[model samples]
Target chain A: MTVTDNPRSYHYSDNFLDFTDEPARSRITKFEPGNAAREQTILRKLGINGWGRWQYFRTCFSDQWGESKQRPLSPRSQDRFFEALEKLRIPKDSKASVFLTDEGNLELVWLDDADEQVQIEFGPKDFEVYIEGSGIDDQYSYDRLDEIIDRFFAG
Target chain B: MSVSGTEDIARAICSDKWDAETGILSASLFKGAETSVSRLSITPLEDTWTVFRKNVEKPPERLLDRIGIINVQSLMDIGSNFEANPTRLSVEPDPLDGYPSHAIIPQKISRGLANKILKSLDIREEVK
Candidate 1:
């Protein structure tokens, strides 16, 4: 049967009954690492040595340990990230690469971080942030910086 | 294929149509509604096929734009969006792969400079 026909049955059949009613936004806000060691293992598994592309080598440079992109990690951004790290539930294992977006200066891509597969896109330079994935695609423009940080990052 | 064989496949894609219920882009290779053995395929795995497939989808007239509806377009778009603009990636193989070394080119590498980098890395551009 089509998914819309009987979502309950479909969920039971696909074993997606585990899917939570809690929103992807809640998942991002409530995320917290089990421990530092657990997060380190994930970085190691995902290969921590990402480098810049040969063609666009300069702008997309990365240290791979944590930083990704030519620009050094912003002190404010890093501090915010550390604060988020206390709450964000990083996935156990996945192909997701947490990197910085280059659209308008380096932005945080807390991309695909949770079990719900939520991807958040944020930019301080251009004053824009958005959250997407798990079938959700919404935007938070330059005006909503404080709201985004308080809702999604601040615990 | 010969001139006529190529023409037959094009006709099938238009008249006979495609079987895109599956993600694959397959059009009958022969003229008639003959056996399904004769078919041409386009998959997203091959890097260059997209350039041609994209060309096919450019004509905005078709009511049923097979290429547009198929999920492969999104796959290619997302992949291109990500890989075409990546923060970091390295081709240097690990120690197990004989300690492959990569050169750090200058800030702005010329066409010739890029060629030299590839040559130094022993990576010949695939002769298409």
Candidate 2:
């Protein structure tokens, strides 16, 4: 079912709550040697490294680690991972915000403000959702995200 | 010059053979002649030559006119069709695939610059 259709089935767990409360700090702690070592091992297994760190972390945390009920994880633990990411103190000029929906979708909101706002949604189920506030094309939305981030960070 | 010679001069200026006295010809003449040219020649006519020079000169005005003439209903149709049948434009691999890069920001220095701007404008508080 869609996110809106079955919201109750996706109740927020303690892990999700804890991570969301202080995402930046929580993500940093999770990325450390001890807690996310399994995540690192999984990243290695997936042949991901460097810039792929966070993405790989998300994938592993979702598909493998989250799904393994026998372990100390659930099938939607990536929601917690993303919640943690949202709290992280990115550069103030960094207009990117990550959010985890009840339905386990990870949303990346960028270029959000009065003039224009763009949202890129992805999840373990390959759900891709994009919304643009200014009625611009999705390509424009994607390009705007790239432009804002590039212009800000590239300085 | 004869009317045909004047027309030929118009065609030459239109074909960009000789620069016109006013730098470009009138829009009415340009548009009418432009439609008569062969389809294969249209690309060079449109790109290399200033076929839409007048339109380009006042792009904002032209854009506003386009919006006005097309109306919101047609625009909605176009947008819906585009959303339903999006085209794949490129297939290039990402350049910073292996680096510890932020996809949104270009590099650390740009990030710093953005931070400075944000701090100056007090936008950092909103983000925090």
TM-scores for candidates 1 onward, in order? 0.26, 0.21
Error of 1 at A124 (Å): 1.6
DockQ for every prediction shown: 0.01, 0.01
Prediction-by-prediction clash tally: 8, 7
Model 1 C-alpha lDDT per residue in residues A4-71, reported as the tens digit of each score: 88756533455333445543212122233432553454344333421111112122232221101223
Give me the runs in candidate 2 sitting further than 4 Å from their true place: A1-96, A112-114, A125-155, B1-128
Alpha-carbon error at A103 in model 2, in Å?
A: 1.8
Mark the regions of model 1 whose C-alpha exceeds 4 Å error after superposition. Answer: A1-76, A103-117, A125-134, A141-155, B1-128
Model 1, B2-99: lDDT tens per residue? Answer: 11222111111210122222121111111111111111232222332233233322222211222221122222233234422321211111111221
For model 2, residues B1-128, the per-residue Cα lDDT tens digits are 11111111101112111112212111111111111111112223223123323322221211111100111222223323444442211111112322111011111211112112222221000111
Clashing pairs in 2: A24-A87, A24-A88, A66-A74, A153-B110, A153-B111, A154-B110, A155-B110
Superposed by TM-score, candidate 2 places the C-alpha of residue A63 at a distance from the truth, in angstroms, of 14
* Candidate 1 lDDT (Cα, 0 to 1): 0.28
